[model samples]
Structures are given as C-alpha cells and as structure tokens.
Target: MMGNKILRKIVATVKSESKGINYFSHQSTAADSYVYSILVDETSDISSCEQVSICIRYCNSQFQSQEDFVGFYATSKTDSFTLYNLVKDSLLRLGLSIDKLRGQGYDGGANVAGKISGLQKRLSDDYPRALYFHCAGHNLNLVVQDACQMSPVIGDAMSCLNKVVVYIRDSPKRWDSFNTLLASHEEVSGCNIRPLCATRWVLKLQSVDAFLHTYEVILDFMQTAHSEKSNSASMRSTAFSLLRKLEDFTLYFSLRLLQVLFKAVDPVHRNIQSKTITIGEVLTQVSSLANFLASNASFIASNAKNDDSVAHFTSCKEFASKLHLNFACVPRGVRVSAEDYFCGLYTGLFQTASESILIRFQAKSLQMAENLRRVLEDESIEDGIIKTVSEFYDDWNYIDILRERRQWFNICRHEGLQPSINSLRTQFKSELTYKLLLPNIRSALTLYIVIPATTCEAERSFSALRRLKTYLRSTQTQVRLNNLALMHIHRDDFIKKVDLDDAMNEFIDRTTTRRNKFGIGNK
Candidate 1:
C-alpha cells in the first residue's frame, strides 16, 4: 500500500508538470522482449532549459491480447502488425491519443525501416503526421562503415591497425612491454592503446589517434618482440610485417584521410545524439557537413594537378600538420603525391559518404525539417507559414487565436525582437499555451518541442537494462527487474522530487500495527 501510494504520487507529479507525452522511443531488447520509453518536456522553475526524462512504461515478456503495463509482450512472431498492435494497445491503455504522437525513433532494421510492411509504415497509415526517422547516430555510423568498406586500401589499413591493437592486448608480456616503452618515451608518455570495435565506428577515430600518438613506442615494442627468444617464429614474422605496414606512406595517407573525414562528421554526430536537439538543427548540421566534404573534394582535386615536388611536399606537410602526423617520416617509395592520395580518398570515401547521408535521410523528413526551420526563422506570415499550417493543422479550428498569434508576432517584430524560434517561444510561451490559442497550433508547437531528434534515450534504457539484468541477476522476475531498473534510471528525479516525510506518513498509515509494535514515531 505504501509503495502504491508513492508510485501514484510520482506519476501524478509527472503528468501534472508535463504538458503532454509528445514522443515515444521503442526497442526490442530480445527476440521475445521489448521496451517502450516515454519522453515529455518538463519546464524548469529555476532555469530556461527544459529537462527530458525517460519514464519506463513497459518492460515485460508476456504475449496476450490487452496485456497490461503499456504494452510489453513476448511472442515468437516478428511482423509489422504484431508490433503495431502492441504499440496501439499500449497507447490506448495509457489514455494517450495516437493523434498526439509526433515522432517515432528506432534502429534502422528491415522490420522497422521496410517501406511496404514495416512497423513505421503501419503506424503511418493511422497517424500520418507522426514521422518516422532512423536514428541519426546510427546513420552516421553507417556512412563511415560504407565509406571504409568501399575502399580496399582503407579496409586493409584499418585491419592492420586492429591487428596491432590485438597483438599487444592478447599477450600480457607484449602489452606490458608496450606500456613500458610508452612510459619511457617522454613525448608519448601515459598514452594507452585503444582497441577498435566493429560495431562502434567512433572507436575507429580513437584507435587511429592512439596509434599515431604512440607510434614510436609501438614501433619499439614491435622490434623488441621480433627479437625476443620466447616469441614464436610466426609471431615474429607477423610483427615484422605489421611493423613495415605501419610505416608505409600509403597507410599514413589513408589514416590522415579518415581522421579528417571523421573529424568533420564527429561534431554533427554528437549533436544528433542529444535529446534536446531538434530535427531542424540536425538537418542543418548534416547539410553543412555534406557541403563541407564536397568542397574538400574539389580542393583536393585542384591541388592534385600541381606536379612540382616542392609544392607537392608543401601540400603534404599542410595536410599532415592538421592531423599532427610527422610527414617527414613518410617513406620515399610511396610515389603517389599527397594531393593524388587525397584526391583518390575524396573521390572513393568522402564523396560517397556525403551522398550516402543525403540518400538515407528521407525527402519527407528533410521537407518537414525545412518547414520547422522556416517557422523558426521567418518573422512574418509568409508562404512557408501557410504551408506549415496547411500541412500540419488540417484538424485544427481556432482561427481567432491564430490571428491573435500572428498579431503578437508582428508586434514582437516591430518592437525589435529577434525572429528566431527560441526567442519567439521564450517571449510568447504563455500566449502559445493559453486556452484561447488554437489547439492544433499549440499541438504543433508542443510536438515540435518534444519530438525526439534521436533514439538515444531508448538506447540508454537498453544499456541500463543490460546492467540491471546481468548474468548474476539473470533469474530475477520481470516485475522486480522493471522496478529496479526504474529506480536506478530515475534516481535523479527521486533524489530531487520525492518527499520522504509524505512517504513515511503513508507507510505509517498503511501499517499501524507494525508501527505500534516497533514504537516508531513520526517527526
């Protein structure tokens, strides 16, 4: 009874403080298990920033018609209708209208991304306004993966880099020796080798950076291992071959190219993972990055035409300087000039990556993003605003409120207020939420604010699930697991908002006999 009271109080606080649950991120944890997380915008009383919290609605393994807990079910089948029905039932049980859902985020999978019979397609049939987007971070990873795979030279170079990390990590002696050498070098002291993971593309950047930073130490360790009597002949042979490959000019050129390309996209990648970022901002960053890469390709091609060795070497030095690589150490046997290498890399890798990003992000998603951008930027009632209202507000009916809003917008502009969306929202939050405002206009604005630009929140919940349901606690019941996971994930909220005195009073009221028996007194 005490726990039930506390749970009700917490839910009440969330529902009262939040305007509405605007977006949901869903992911399947196992073949038979799934989790749906709710995200809502909570205004901070103390600051201007809005906080996003993940309320875990369902985490279970039961398959039935109308099963409780906001739709977690276990089933043998994996089809679009099954998933859609689960979500629909869950939303209905929560008393949330399907019409209010503005966005859906998921991993790029056939069951989710398929155009004909996918979960996204099925959901769109009922809620055409709810947009489906593949997770932005995952798309960036795909870009890197595709670019690397398209070039055999880059692939082989990455393999060699991975092999180097593995060779040292697999043996304690070699690993210790590498560390010892690293410490002995003053310039590279305290640098640790980073292992590359196939699934995590960001680690590729770290791996390459670590290798370059500790190059001399790694080379020294490899030479020592080659001469060690305890080392097998095959091990020595492999070490010698790897050492030669690491020193090759072509490998360094490939590394430099990848480093530059990753550097360009890394900022945008990090930005999209943020729960607070809007789709408009993400699209802008992506478009800018694509353009940046295109210009870089053109620059490389232009430089490739110069045949003067002095000029060629200067270009090499300039490129290496940006990556902090020692261009003087590049071997003479690599006859391909730096410009030629960069041109090839730009054509084979960066250009394809840029094109791939634009291709994968759907045209409809881009159009919506542009509409939001225009709404955020424009100061007056323009064609873009009309287009937005027509496309998003067909069901809305409060023209008087919209007219008032337009008048307020003009007044703000006349008073010299900046025309940015954030500025407008900040100045007119009350008007936007007033009862007189058209419900459709309010809904559109609120949805734009709360629509998740990424599925990072869902991914984070999956990570928490893994930690909570580790091998040692694998046999715990689903209810217990769900409670524990919620407590752990929302510890911040519990610390900040939960009142101990109220909970204790409720506990005392529910267990009077136990309280009397223990002679416990309330403060």
Candidate 2:
C-alpha cells in the first residue's frame, strides 16, 4: 500500500512536469473497452489431503482464462476459515465479484454437495440469482447404477465377469492368445476382442462376447494359473454359467429399451444455450419408459405369483397398470392446456384410479416344465424344438420374442431359465405398453431434445479445470484454488480489466504520429 501511494505521488509529479501528454487520461479511458465474464467449479482429492484446485476465467475477447494448478494446501488440518478466506482474496485480486457470477455446475456427489450444502449453497447464500445445475450426464449414470442393483443375479454375474476379465487382462500372453483364437474363428480377425471396463456398458457387451468366444482358450490358460489357483470344477461351472447369463444381459440391452432411455435422457444436458427443453416433454418420455418397464416388470411379477411353488417374487402388474393409466393422463397437442383432458385439464381423471393401484415387483421363474420336455423328445438338428431355441439365443437382435419351440429346448436342457423366465410374456406386455405410450414419450423427447439436462455439462466444467490452474502449482492455497477454480470455470462471463499500460503505449504512438503529420501541414 505504501509503495503504491509513493508510486502514485511520483507519477502525479511527473505528469505535472509534462506539458502536452495526458498519460493518465489515456490510460483511464483505454481501460474501459471490453468485458470478460467468468464461471467456476472446483475439484479436490479428499483422501490424501494433498489438496489442489483450479480456477478458470475467460474473457469475452480472445484471452480465455484457464489454469492447470490454481491452489494447493494440506487438507488434513486446514479449517474452513482459511479455505474460505483464501478464495475470497484471490477473486478480489482478480477483480471478480460474487455478483458477477452467471452460473455454477458440479457433479452432485457426497464429496461435492448439492443445492442444499457445500459450495453451491454457500455461493447461493451470497449471490441469490447465480444459476446452478447438477450435471445431467452424471445423473443418468447414477440412474443406471440404481437400475442395475435391483437384480441380484445380474449383480453376481457382473462381479464374476469382472474377476475373469481382471485375470486375463493381468496376463498379456493369455490376453493376446485369447484374441488370436477369436481371430481364427471368423473372417474378421480380432475385431471382436474388447476389454471389460467397470463403468462403460457398451464396451462391456463386446467384452462379454469376446470372453464367451475364447472361453476354452481362457480355461486352458487358467489351468496353469497362479492368482486364482483354486479353480475347482464348481468354480469353472459357475464361471461358464455366469458367462451365459452375461450374454443374456447383453442381449437384453440390445433391445430398444436402453436406446429409448438414452433418447429420452438426451435432452436436458447441463450446458445452457439459447435452446431449452420443457418439463412437459421430459415427463412424457419418463411416462413412456415407465410404462414400458412397468409392463415387463408387471408381467414377470404376475407370472411369479402364479408359480406359488417358487421363491419370493413380487408381481408388478399393479404398478404397470397404474403407469399405463398415467400415459392416458398425459395431454396431447402442441399448445397443451390444463383444461384439456389429454393435456392437463383432466388432471383429476387419474386421481380416483391412482389410489387403488398397488405397486409390486417380482423375480420371474427361470425354470419351466414344458421347456424340459422338448429337449428330451429331440436331439438332432432335424428336430424343430432344439434347432429353433438354439437359433433364438444366438441371434442378437431377436430380443425376447421366444417361440414355444425355445421353451421346449429349455425343458430338454433342464436349464431353468437362469434369469427371467417371464421374459417373453414381459416382452409382450412391454411391447404393448411401448405402443401405447410411445406418442407421449416421443413428443416429450422431441421437446426436450433441444435442451440437454445430462451431466455432460459437468464433464465440460472439469475439462476446463484440467486446463487452467497450471501456474499456481505449489503455493496456491486451497481457498484461492477453490475461488480461482470457480472463477475460471465461469471466466467467460467475467469482464476482464484492460491492461492500461498496453493501451497507453498504443495511444501515445498514434497521438505522436498524428501530431508530427499535422506539424508537416498534412492534417
């Protein structure tokens, strides 16, 4: 502060001594040309307490603010006071205001609090109008996790599959040999080899297929195993069974259900632009998907109820019926009015029926008596039952349309449909439900497709963090890091202060050149 005061006095004295130049005036005027807007988000590794955060700020002009390293601090013992003050100080120095904040985004997890807690809530307490959204893509992924956990068989199969994948992947020679074997089977060499990854679903499907194709080779390699030396007969049998179950799961995914879900969720992704998707549309898509899943779930549940001899399973018929009714409750047309029964006018139409409908979900019986009969009756390819059922399972696109012949094959194999026995019936119900509910879902999807609600926005925000926060690697404090991270993330909105020195230099050069020309009588 004292140095700045002394500098100001010196500059003023110099200006007073000058006769023609108004350097300060030129500097002040040039500082007001353009505005830079900034947005911000922060990431921290809480485990190690080796805390670091990034702040990115970008101007409306060419200089986009980014940082690779913004702040670093030991989190093991730091209090919130130090953290909060650090951020405040950094922003103040950068000439950013809490008021200038346009938007905020985060991956709503325990580490990063939601609207109710953490940075967003704190910022909201300060700047009320700051637009905040949870990343939509992240939400979608969570939804997938929820859906998967609902079935234990699927959970186990996935676990076993992961184990096999890890074993093979750990050995390069085994993994390569496995691929080589697959290459020899078909014209396409090793085109089918895919590594199993935990979170990636699409890639996992190809990996499952690769594993199944090279099962024999894998077993042979495993015979000389070291890590899983306890590969007993039962373990081998379970692995093979799990492999088939995975195949079934993959087959089920190939159905249009997952595709439809993707389509439904595509809109409402986080990044806000001019385009916007409406709530009405999102609701419609949800209703359609719900109706479809409910029907299938209902059918499976109902079938399980009929087979009282089987273990625990709840019938979802009531929920399916209720959701089906929900579809009817949706209002159609572009200008949907509340008064319109199909739109929202007849909101009360579903009220009466909604109360009575019950919600039930059940696991279907995989085994059937009739499926056993077909396998015993015929062993040759000429026999219709075995041939038909084998063909059905082999076709990836067949979905769940199982003919009676396939049921006969299951009976012969004595394989109680290891997973969902009511698949065909469930499919029937789902297809019917899909047909009934598609119009509404489609309309809603079309409406919301223009707006992204998924966490793709969160991914984008993190991408910026990795780019900025580069310079302040070691000395960067956690609070400064957090503030800087948020600032640079939203830097696009921050009005960057013009560099007065550069502006003054340009101004002096132009002014001097003009004066010289005028003196030469060239004005």
Q: Which window of 10 residues has the lowest lDDT sum in candidate 1? A: 59-68
Instruction: Tell me the tens digit of each residue's lDDT in model 1 across 261-322.
Output: 77887788887776556666777788898887665544344454322323434555665566
Backbone clash count for every predicted candidate, in the order shown: 0, 64
Q: Model 1 misses residue 143 by how many Å?
A: 2.2
Tens digits of per-residue lDDT, candidate 2, 395-425, equal: 1112222333354345435744322223322
Each candidate's TM vs. the true structure? 0.77, 0.41
The TM-score between candidate 2 and the true structure equals 0.41
lDDT, candidate 2, equals 0.36
Span of ten consecutive residues with least summed lDDT in model 2 = 360-369
lDDT, candidates in the order shown: 0.59, 0.36
